[model samples]
Target: MKVMNCPLNGPRNISEFAWGGEVKPMPDPAGVGDKEWAAWLFLEANEAGVVREWWCHVPTSYWFIAERNNITDEIIKTYPATEVFNTRVEFAAKAGAGEKK
Candidate 1:
């Protein structure tokens, strides 16, 4: 069984965590075309070397980042999401846009 180090909870069973997805930069939606938006939503590098991704501790609902090797499935390091995703970008709803109640 694989073990993953949780930034907040320490080391734990891999089953206790969820793979959130690869960590990537969010594109500026207003300046990009539909194709770019679609790619961002659907595509992943899926590279064979070390890749950075997001993982969540199921019990605590805590999310963090992990750097692991895709080929060997070895976790290199883990850190809080804030360390990498420090900038928060807020997208304002445009006029006439449907808002969720």
Candidate 2:
């Protein structure tokens, strides 16, 4: 059986995890146009070498990062997202947005 080491839950069955996507710098949602936003949301680099990606532990709903080689399909390492992302970005609500009439 395949195994994956989750940062929060330790080693577990690969079935217990879900592949989120490649870890990339998020563009400013409010500043980008429809095309740019769409690309960011749907597109991927699909690189061949070792790439960092986001993964989730389904049972615990815990998300973390994994570095794996696409060609070899080998997981090089895994770690908590906090190791790469230390600061949180807050998006301010627009004026008169989502208010009842």
Against the true structure, what is each candidate's TM-score?
A: 0.90, 0.91
User: Per-residue lDDT of 7-95 in model 2, one digit per residue for the tens?
Assistant: 89999999999999999998886787889888988899998999999999999999999999999989899999999999898887978
Q: What lDDT does model 2 reach?
A: 0.93
**TM-score winner among the candidates?**
2
TM-score of 2: 0.91
Worst lDDT run of 10 residues, candidate 2, spans 29-38
Tens-place lDDT digits, model 1, residues 10-78: 999999999988999889967878899889888998988999998999999999999999899999999
Q: Model 2: which residue pairs collide?
A: none
In order, the Cα lDDT scores of the candidates are: 0.92, 0.93
Most accurate candidate by lDDT: 2
TM-score of candidate 1 against the unseen true structure: 0.90
The regions of model 1 sitting more than 4 angstroms off are 99-101
For model 2, the stretches where C-alpha displacement exceeds 4 angstroms are none
